[model samples]
Target: MMQHCNKMLHHYIQQSHSNVTIKEIIPGKLQGRIASPTSKSYAQRALAAALLVPESAHPAGWSELRRMGLCNDTSAALDAIQRLGASVRYGDNRDTYYIEGGFLRQAPAELHIGESGLSARLFTPIAAQSPTPITITGHGSILRRPVAASMVAPLRRLGATVTDGANGCLPLTVSGPLRGGTVEVDGSLSSQFITGLLMASPLSEAETRLLVRQPRSLPYLAMTLEVLRTFGIEVTHAPDYTEFVIPGRQQYRPTVCSIEGDWSGASCLLVGGAIASELRGAGIIVENLNPRSLQADRAIITALERAGAILASSGHLWTVGRPATLRSFEFDATDCPDLFPALVALAAFCSGTTVLRGTNRLTHKESDRAATLATEFAKLGVEIDLSTPDTMAIRGISTSDGSLTVRDPRLDSHNDHRIAMATAVAALRADRPVTITHAEAVEKSYPHFWDDLDTLYTA
Candidate 1:
């Protein structure tokens, strides 16, 4: 089984060698309707939940989720599941994945998470449920990230022997059948830690009481609960999202679940529409966008409105157009840090200076996002100042008439997907064609991002 997982890992490695470069985007009126991809965030969560419950017991249609195309992160979780004794098979549909779970027996020697923050963080605690010693590791940008003592501290408190690697990154070995107990998790760094514990708590030997401190990304926790409920797992928590209670020895009943559209990825498309609408009279209509999605990036709408973009929504369909006048606005992105890039892109087109708060969380992502955004946008002649540790001010360059000061510049993605997508969106209003290197990085979340952008532009 480990050998099979190694093969899968090699396949992914071979696939990543292909690189793509984006030529300068034509500034114009963009028009078209495109549905965002199923949320990898949601899909990864559901896949984790499914691993805890066997297929025979799950609800009908649950197998359909297996048929969907797997993202790099989702693929990692699935491969890890197989290594942990579960059998994954394809249905007659050939696309649907049917996982016969509950077989967690011989824990593999190692589990590899490839550039998936969610997979690495969320799967670690869950994998500890097996008494066998297993090491958790990952690839690329994930290696540079600090696993931090906080991530393993809660598990250690719960009776798991965890040893971090020399660099304190991956290859952390855990020996446990995590015996749940009262534990405190520092939630400031990431909510993924809390999410991992919540997913695995029900299977613990004792009821679990998890107290979280200063939890950010609360929406992601809400989404975790939603997915847990879908799989017949119950957890009690406060409205403030500070604490959670889970019954011991609880069973997870699997059910059919579908991954929803991703607002994080859609924010890029919407911003592109807003910028393009300014150039061409045509507006962009985005489909599969859930107005009530638990994603933090849904706040993009607020940022757009604040920047004076005209938005109209009916059900799941949303349209964005340039406002008669765009102005700088102040936004606090502390709760939704993923919106920083898209907000920055929109801010570049506005007439005045825009202030975006919540720079603290940017350093731990795929890249030093805050620094990367500032450096990359500077090439386009936009000035971004990180005046304080947690605030970024974007001084928009525009003529007195409020038209964007577009210029021909080449930007680098720094191997960050959001940065690549954000740079492309900002290009919509550029004075000349903008070239973005390492544009293929967008595949980390949105594989069809360039395709969708081309669709909207050519339509």
Candidate 2:
């Protein structure tokens, strides 16, 4: 039988002509304005909904998917949907995309997740809900990424039988009628598992109550609650998220939900401004942002504030402006791991030294992010020393030459959306252009990321 498209895959390159790279300089004064992209978290939730709701599962219904913002991660989420069962068609008008969603008649013998850690983790539970056996796998560097066996043990206990090549590694096989009851997962590993179980719980024979072993990322669970509400799946939970009560049966309403713009993606834009002080002062504004969001990346504002960046949040709109003197400060990234890259960029431009903690979660991303950041930043005369496995100290430096140098122009994102966006932002501030080898990796989160950057970078 054919395996999931995780190992030994192929992508036929379409664009034959090469692109150009230049020594670009982000003026010391650059503007701090760019529309935030769509939340990949929202996109993943929507894909799961489209698959679960029998009525909306079809290629033609995909046009119902609209853009709240630029979505590279959502693009990968849609790709996984299509690869699994649904067929999606983009309308000719360039404004509409169609989803042919429906439960797989026979479990797709193999479910391939192309470089999406969220897709791989969340879909495992969803696939286990299906009638037949399904094997899940992911491409690129995810093969070696760790999975919390502690997280999977519950799903196995509740019914769904599973198998994998290594210690809870990818190529996860699930066959089940998830006998959902009580499940416990560690929030520190990855919240996507919690989201997967939550998505699969409504259809389970029994209600599922989750007990977070050590709650780390509460914001992610909050985002899950918001998405579940959007689908009309009412979930009742205690304030502490220590418990969850999911009704056995659910009716998913076809939603005209407008996904909120991503604070995660916007963090990079804000940090870019913090690095290039020229963009501050006036005429740089970001609108339509929620001051109160369940996204941990919202802490980017706090990090910027700690580093001497100006921030003003008015209801749904927020703005980040440059400060006269940026200072170095230590930060704990336990909750907001995704912001590490953006924070690193800002940290590099600050005076003195900044030490960022919580590197444990950095391994399973699109690439070995800590090493990637250190290696790339090294080319620009910035000093990043990883003394411990879980801590990194960055010594800031001032850019003397107009072009901030990057040694490896051939750097690849290894298909991590955050990496792609972060590298693009670094390019803006660097004296030299950054030609990310796998530039297409942005599809995992913000598909139109380059387009959005083009608007501001060329302005």
Q: Candidate 2 residues 227-319, lDDT tens each?
A: 888766878887887778887767555455556677887777777666654544642455555677788888988888899887776676666
The numbered model that scores best in lDDT is 1
Residue-wise C-alpha lDDT for candidate 1, range 1-459, written one tens digit per residue: 111121111011122455444444555556778887668888888778877775455463233464255667767888887787667777686546776566375578888888988888888898788788878888888888886456777889998889887666877888788888899888887898789899988989899999989999999999999999887888999998899999978877756655678888899889877776644355788888889988888899998888878889999899988766678999999888888999998888787789999899888899999999988888777899997779999998765544345443767788889998898777666666666777668878888777677666641
lDDT of every model, 2 decimals: 0.78, 0.68
Worst 10 contiguous positions by lDDT, candidate 1: 1-10
Runs in model 1 deviating more than 4 A are: 1-24, 55-69, 90-95, 103-106, 278-282, 400-408
User: TM-score for all predictions?
Assistant: 0.91, 0.83
Error of 2 at 150 (Å): 5.0
Candidate 1 global TM-score? 0.91
RMSD of each: 6.0, 6.7
